[model samples]
Target: MKIAIIGTRGIPNHYGGFEQITEQLATGLVERGHSVTVYNSHNHPNVAKSWKGVSIQHCYDPEHMLGTAGQFVYDLNCIRHARKNNFDVWLFMGYTSSSVWHSFFPKNSIIVSNMDGMEWKRTKYAKTVQRFLKYAEKLAVKHSHFHIADSPAIKDYLDKKYSVNAKFIPYGAVLPAASEEETLRQYNLAKDDYFLLIARMEPENNVEMILDGFSASNCKKNFLVIGKTENKFGKRLVGKYGSDNRIKFLGAIFDQETVHALRANAQLYFHGHSVGGTNPSLLEAMASGSLIAAHDNIFNKAVLGNDAFYFDCAACVKALLEKTVCTETKKTFTRNNTEKIRQQYSWDKIIDAYENYFFECCQSAKNESYVSSKRWACK
Candidate 1:
């Protein structure tokens, strides 16, 4: 099958969940002997021309600063590419891009969109942006041949609000091997001496809350939070908590090896996502075999199972700190969760589900085409 995947920054995994998902699925499809081409935004630096087995098709996005307009620019360009190359199917992620492409693209094209979460509910967006996002979400559901929710939590949202039944396909996780000792030395973090939190410093991520909780704790364990510092919210977070030597803020960690080592060697993994479906950070933490201290959400519980620890407030965090004997039990729980993730959330398994979904969407399109042809013949 010739597949065209769009709505991602690029390959390699330097970006967020969507980029990682795109890279993994495209590559996995290629490995299965399917022809897959990814339309990546040329705004970001090139990580690779080919990742795993997937081919990259870099495209221009000039209206980047215009936010939603920039997305439209990219989507239309990708649609043009799809039509020009005669791609068999079009798969995309993100609600805004999906909404735009589905509304404008050829009706016969097999379109499968993965709308991961109620992104409009995120606090970062102002009133106007949220209103637009809500409408865009509806457009995405109404127009796509099929929609994918990264978690049951997100699926429920779509079902309730849009009356749309989407296939629930969770995100995948890759178990990164331990990095060399030199990698740890480079970050000045000794193995097992510190805990790690790897996520965007967005309001929904609850970075401030996590910092307050960790700060209130009496545990001597150090903290290393790694993510981009481009946003104003991120800068304010840095300004507030960065002075404390115990809490180190390394801005924009692009190196995969360094990130893996940080997670793999940490005493614990802190996940502060107050919103969204199964987070990639949480999945990556499980893959790295780190004991999780996550926000109290059904999504987190579902992903990590009951054995993983949860906290709703700083009091709970302090309580966990008072008893720092989490080493043995936490590791055991982490290993158990790791085994579960290996069985359920591997890239091979998730991508195969996506592949099957695309094939099904194509079948649906063919059936519709056949019916239309039959009606025309009768006419």
Candidate 2:
């Protein structure tokens, strides 16, 4: 099948989760004998026409200059480019900016949208922006021929709200190989001596709350915050907690090896993301065999189940930090999470699920067309 993937910055995965997924999925699909093209931002680091076996289509993106509003222009450019292609399937990675241009999508192609997290619920956006996002979400549902939900909770919400049976396909991760102990030396840290939290310093991610809890706790271990500190919330966090020598604000580290090493060796990994379905970082931490203490929410609970610890507020995080768990329990938590990664969230399994789902959607579209033609003939 000819597939075109949209709604991400680029393919070589210089950015975050959606780009990473696109890189993996596009390459995987190409390897499986399907022609796949990924729409990338012109400013993306990788300027190559192709990476691995997947084709790359670069479009102008002005997000750097225009800020958030530039994303709409970028998506519009990508859609204009995509309108020229006669692809069999067009997979939208998310419905944030592209959904507004749903009318421009190819008339013959099957439109499949991966409805990301509940965007309106995010605390980062203003109320007006949230309302716009909610309207965009509805537009995506009403226009697309099919929907893909990365978590069961999201799927349930879509089914109830829009009366559509969205397919449940979560993100995937790879289990990291054992790393050298020398990696810890660079950070001036010992194995299991520091706590770790890796996420964009966003309000929905609860970075500040986690830091607050850690600062209030009696634990003397260092708490490493691994994300860019240039954002407003991040700078505020740095100012508020920077005085504490134990709370180290290590700026964004994209190196997978270093990140996996940190996750593998940390005493505990805190996942504070309250939005989104099946976060890539949480899966990475699990794949690295990190003992997790996640924010108490349906999204995190749906993935961790009974395997990891849960916390709701700052006090809960503080209590968890101070509380002592036996080595056996720690082993159980890590082991269970890693096992979950191996069985459910492996890259191979995710690729296979997508491959099968795409074929199903194509076949379903064909059948519906045939039925509609038959009714027209009878009329």
Q: Could you tell me the TM-score of candidate 1? A: 0.91
Q: Write the per-residue lDDT of candidate 2 for residues 1-379, one digit (tens) a residue.
A: 8899999999788779988889889999889888999999999888999989999999999999999889999999999998898777889999999999987887777889999999899998999999999999999998888999999999999999999999999999998888747789888999989999999999999988888899999999999999998989889989999789999988999889999999999999999999989899999999999999999999999999998999989999999999887899999988998899899998888999988998887778777761122211100
Q: What TM-score does each of the candidates earn?
A: 0.91, 0.97
User: How much lDDT does each candidate structure score?
Assistant: 0.77, 0.90
Determine the C-alpha RMSD for candidate 2 after optimal superposition of all C-alphas.
3.2
**Model 2 stretches with alpha carbons more than 4 Å out:** 370-379
